[model samples]
Target: MNNRYSSNSAGVFTWFRDAAEQGNAYAQFNLALLYKRGKGVQRDDKVAFVWMREAAKQGIAFAQNHLGAMYYNGTGTPPDDSEAVYWFRKSAKQGDASAQQNLGLMYRKGRGVPQSDEMALTWFCRAAEQGVASAQSLLGEAYAQGLGTKRNFPLALAWFRKAALQGDATAQLNLGLMYRRGHGVLQSDTQAVAWYRQAAAQGLAAAQRHLGVAYAEGRGVQVDLERACSWLRRAADQGDVDAQFNMGVMLSNGYGTRKDEAQAFAWYHRAAAAGHMLAQYNLGGMYAHGRGVQRDPAQALVWYRKAADQGAPNAQFNVGVIYANGHGVPKDEARAVAWYRHAAEQGDASAQNNLGVMYANGQGVPQDDAEAVRWYRRAAEQGHPLAQYNLGGMYASGRGVERDPVLSYMWISLAAEAGDETACNNRKLIERKLTREEIGSAQALTRRWRDAHRA
Candidate 1:
């Protein structure tokens, strides 16, 4: 008996035939691999499974692992998580590191059994201690988040460093982030740059993006917009949405090359299609303002809706405006206010000021000067000049609170200092009317309040 597929001189068919008959485990596994991948043979899952089963029954750990993977990924047989788990357990019991890692993944992701972080940790710990870089990285993540152990930043850093040193690109990038953001180690931009450079050389998209940022900002590296654009373009070419968006902006503004609206639009469209919220917002603006495409309010609203669904504040506000003005749909005051409120909650200054106006004019809600004043104050505290001006008017006219010209001038002057042209003119008009001593006293109180607020 012989393996027809294992023939050195004889034809492959004769080799596989002899190998199949002779019960050669390696030959059987190799034949299965060929059949599974349709290499030197027609793809036959049933035949592949049959051959692999024979090898696995022979206690060949490699065959056992491949057979388990086939079951796990549904490549040869109906996907059977339980069967995959069973064979993986057998291989793991035999001390197969790959099987150990696979078993750990199944437990961690709850693929075959009830999820058990502790069990996952146990397997990952075993593999990691055996010098498995992936397991080390996973263990680092678990330690960082305290998945099955007490949160230990020092342990996480050690494990991440170990895995990073092993040339695991993911570990390298993640360790770089830890150093860059001071997550589990002292913030060391130099170390961050080193790790990032290693991972970037391996073409890891995330590491490339971070490296691009490092280069652009002169953190640990001299500022080089050209280098930043190069790395960003590489990641963007790989369909990294964040990288695509950043590269698109650079292209749109001619950061390192002549402005190319067409190319910028294409990149933005790709990122937006990938569910990048910010890209969707930018594309929406392009449609609305005719920057790269013909002005199409309907398309603008469509893109805006996509971003708004992902909780983008600016997109939500823009969509609301379109609805309010009947640009894309029939005028809907209620919907407009809804979007305005969403943007305001996200700390959008313009949206906050708009919300105050909405409350004041009762466009979509009942007129309530108190609500208006509340919103205006919120925006004013954030240095919204218009909000400060509105607050001053409220104080001067007693629209929301008791009338007080001194308090009004205080807000007006604050707005003026913040470069509100209208506030400056109004202050001048009020200055000509107020008595000199009264103006001096008002100015004194303003100074004290400003000093207290550090404004």
Candidate 2:
């Protein structure tokens, strides 16, 4: 219920005071509203509470609802959940839709009553049936998630449509998602875009970000990088981390805008501060390569470690490189080995190759040709040119298994095709040791391997 009151007529305050003195409930409620808003009266929560209490005691449903809100929020009196619940229950039983919705929220959150999805659903149904838009939205969500009811996509769609038609931003967003995912509706990018536009116009940040991505990817609309940037900026201004990251990428790559590395760095830093893993990794790159800031190995390591701690394989590999190369820290081959192992276990080919080199040289691990061959094979299967060359050398020298010239030739030839200069030179030397028929067999094996592993 709106509590705004105007003292436009002359002597209105005096008239209200006289009526309230004579026990007029409307006059008391109106006077309380005026006092609460400081309209032609001194703002005094205590006075407002006293007058509101008098009106509520006289069975004024609106006043009782307001009293409950005031108690719940500690606006006029100390917060008392029980008292708020009592007033809300009284007003709700009298068909006050707002009170009923509020009571439902309280039950859903267990604020003043035991948490009961059934009670929440019952109250929400009552308010929704009375055409309360927010209650309709909540009821739709409950149906969609099967909270206190069977999951019913059709009912959810119906309730969401009702609330969306009433201009509820959240309902519009949810409706857009349903259309996009084909939940209880035919998948239609056009329909999703329409609903997203409604919520985006209402200043919903998530809707703005989703619309930006749709425009960028040409999913629900024609590709429009300028429009995508505009929408992304709007969401980024509202502190949306994904939007901030996207903005950084667009600015850095000069996508539909002039390249602004400094601005991109700022956006990336903002997202990184919010704990975005990719943002942290990119921030480390910027520091390491001096992309938009001065090169600082120490800062690079700091950001890389942050991303690494979050299980970023690339960051872990970079961390290993940094320690192995002694960039802004003491060189520690053992620490490098540990970091490389972490990334290699996650299937990072570069880390696998590096681990193979470490094992072969016995820098941070026991000198074991078998362990080196194991790591090299893992990386080679993933098409790592360096690991293929290393594995070929191991086979030629019989360092791990018995020397096999045909296998060595095939592996080195594969590495040479990948533009490894060392492998190309090594392949020419190994060719002199093989017969013509052996070379033909190795060439055929290479073709079969390439076809089988094509990705």
The numbered model that scores best in TM-score is 1
Per-candidate TM-score against the hidden true structure: 0.92, 0.84
lDDT of 1 by residue, 47-74 (tens): 8998998999999987888889989989
* Model 2 clashing residue pairs (backbone): none
Q: Which residue runs does candidate 2 get wrong by more than 4 Å?
A: 1-32, 42-95, 103-123, 145-152, 363-371, 399-402
lDDT per residue (tens digit) for residues 17-127 in model 2: 789989999999988887788777678998999999999999999999999999999988999888898999999999999999988888888888889888899999999
Name the 10 consecutive residues with the lowest summed lDDT in model 1: 1-10
Model 2 poorest ten-residue lDDT run: 1-10
- Candidate models: Cα lDDT each: 0.86, 0.92
